[model samples]
Target: MLPNVTVNPAAEKFMRRMVRFSGHGDGAGFRLTVSAGGCSGYSAEFTVEGAPLAGDEVLAVGDLKVFLPAESRLMLDGVTIDFSDTPTASGLTFFNPNAGACGCSSSSGTSAQPPGVAKVDISSIRRN
Candidate 1:
């Protein structure tokens, strides 16, 4: 089953731009791959693709199409995806209410993430 993922306005806008400039033509969509790792328990990478790959499910957000792999579908269940463009960091941020605080710490001995928030840095969109 497809996960109940929520894409906030910022994220949707970002995705739309990616698909528009992907140079893949009309049917192109944004492909997102997420995994369990990082201090906040999530890491992600995205690219533009003409269609969904094997085992990938296409998530339709209005006219936008998001190709999500199986692992990403599972991980994004009940999660909210948002885009952040601040002076310090600019990327997609995932917020999972069911997630707990990560036990990992940085050199300062403090957690890198607060709790239930995972930030994925998409410094640039790589063409595939």
Candidate 2:
């Protein structure tokens, strides 16, 4: 597993509540990775998996397990996953210290745009 990645307690609580009903025969946690998509050249990907894959590094904090693939280790270091009940939006959010510039669409329906880092600071939104 990666030695420097961290899982905040707020994120752990959110994960526990979100996955409590998931019928995973084995333990269940999320896998984080980077893929070529979004407005930026790379985008962060997250999926709930039954267990860590062959090359996955499992970051176990509290009862939460976040599986970070070996390929994403460098880009995801010092990243923090958190939950907030902000007035505009609320859910699991990723704040990556390694990201240079990124942005995500805040629009709805077909008018949505790809994610890219922008200077806009929406008080109710979170960025990666």
Please report, in order, the local distance difference test score of every candidate based on alpha carbons. Answer: 0.87, 0.57
How much is the lDDT of residue 57 in candidate 1?
94
lDDT of 1 by residue, 54-103 (tens): 99999999999999999999999999999988777788889999898777
**Cα lDDT over the full model 1:** 0.87
- Candidate 2 least-lDDT 10 residues: 118-127
The estimated TM-scores of all candidates read 0.92, 0.60
RMSD, one per candidate, in order: 2.0, 7.5
lDDT of 2 at 85: 56
lDDT string, candidate 2, 21-126, tens digits: 4556358876667544444434655666788888888777766777778767765566565665556555545555555443444445553323332111123222
